[model samples]
Target: MGRQSPFLLQIGVFILFFILQAATMRDRIIGGREAKPHSRPYMASIQFKGKNICGGALVNRIWVMSAAHCFDNLRPESMQVVLGAHSVTAQEPSQQNFTVQASISHPNYNMETLENDIHLLKLNKAALVNDFVRKISLPKQGEDVTPRRKCIIAGWGDTTDFETHPKALMETNTEVVSRASCNSSWTGSISQHMVCATSPDNVKRGFCSGDSGAPLVCMNRAVGVVSFSSFRCANPRFPDVYTRVSEFISWMEDVMRSF
Candidate 1:
């Protein structure tokens, strides 16, 4: 067909390249750096069959908090929690692995919509509090993080869509996006139960797959739990979503106290 118009062919090639680049960057730890070894003492690698599948935070001596979706169609007995780990592959002396005693997902949690995504795991035994292992404090009941407030999220998730999960923990700075702005961005899909954060200046940074349940630490308190993000992990158009920890403070306390 007349050699298919060289100009049109060039445009098609450019479009294809752009699409491929976007896909490659999706679900990645773009713009993040390796976390200081053992700096996030409360970070937990929620593993299934010895492979880290999600990130969690040690909330108390025996209670680890994560996303309920991380346990969907999964058994608590098959799960293991690794605390004080800098690298998931390394047999660090500070690491302490625990078998899950019970997995308590919010009763109202919806698997389809991922609402009430927060979850708690009870360890078979209490974790020893030491220099390398400790618990992070939870946010106060009804406490809300304001827009532009600085925060951090760390995980061992993939650095790119096609890459394997990172051996070492990685983290990046984030800023809370206003509920209104976030909701608008997501076409009102963001509920009051969720909080949104993104990198400053529209940079690519935030959680990706396998980072589910990672804590969003603000002011040294876990204010949110990683719930979901855009298909492009670092997409500036959509912010990362987390289950607002403050919204479920009562439920969490009740569960922890009961078990």
Candidate 2:
């Protein structure tokens, strides 16, 4: 048999890789659903260079709770939080922007494993409480958010895959999936540090790319931070994973108090 050209072998490998990625992504889309719109006064958009970078909830006048992935390799000076923004384009310059003084991602965070995906941002000045700007309550220690309970999620991420960026300030509803179901779908990688949520039938209710760092809040309490979605939205076999806020409460309080 004749030897294959080196360039031909490389091209064949690239094609195979592309096909595998596509197949994985397609599986996810078939399994997921669209998330519902949410309404909360405490949610804020974290922007960088005029782009919506992540979602955060006001925890106090000077601090916001978000996902550690939001600040991964990002500098404080590059970030700004927009409060009282009903929509990105409609934001009032005066009410929308605040400078960030510092950020602290969990010391044990592992990006590859998505472990401890939590972070806190310190605002340069206290946020003024108003009808549009308020603080979200954190769940008390050991409080459990039961599975299958309805919860709210909000973000500025893309409305769909084809959309390169996120829609301006949107909210959605999804139900917490059972740990059993989530674990089965997630295989052996799901951890106590993570939680899963999705809408029934995987119809019009799931997190999309860029929704990372937003909250999966339940009953007005902070429960989870939107983390990874299976390379596709609404994958039936895989639920959207979030960093369980309850698992990191002590760490959060310690960081906030130290600042």
Which one is best on TM-score? 1
Which portions of model 2 miss their true places by more than 4 Å?
1-38, 164-167
Give candidate 1's error at residue 255 in angstroms.
0.7
Q: Which residue pairs does candidate 1 place in steric collision?
A: none
Query: What would the per-residue lDDT of candidate 1 be over residues 135-190, giving only the tens digit for each residue?
Result: 99998888889999999989887876666567699999999999899988889888
- Local lDDT at 17 for model 1: 80
Candidate 2 structure quality by residue, lDDT tens digits, 1-259 = 9999999999999999866654433101122223332246677788888767678888888898888877877999998898877666564643647889989999999988888898899999999887778889988755667888898777666665544343345556678887778988878777888888887556656775336677778988889888777766755567888888888888888888899
Look at candidate 1 and tell me the lDDT of residue 85: 94
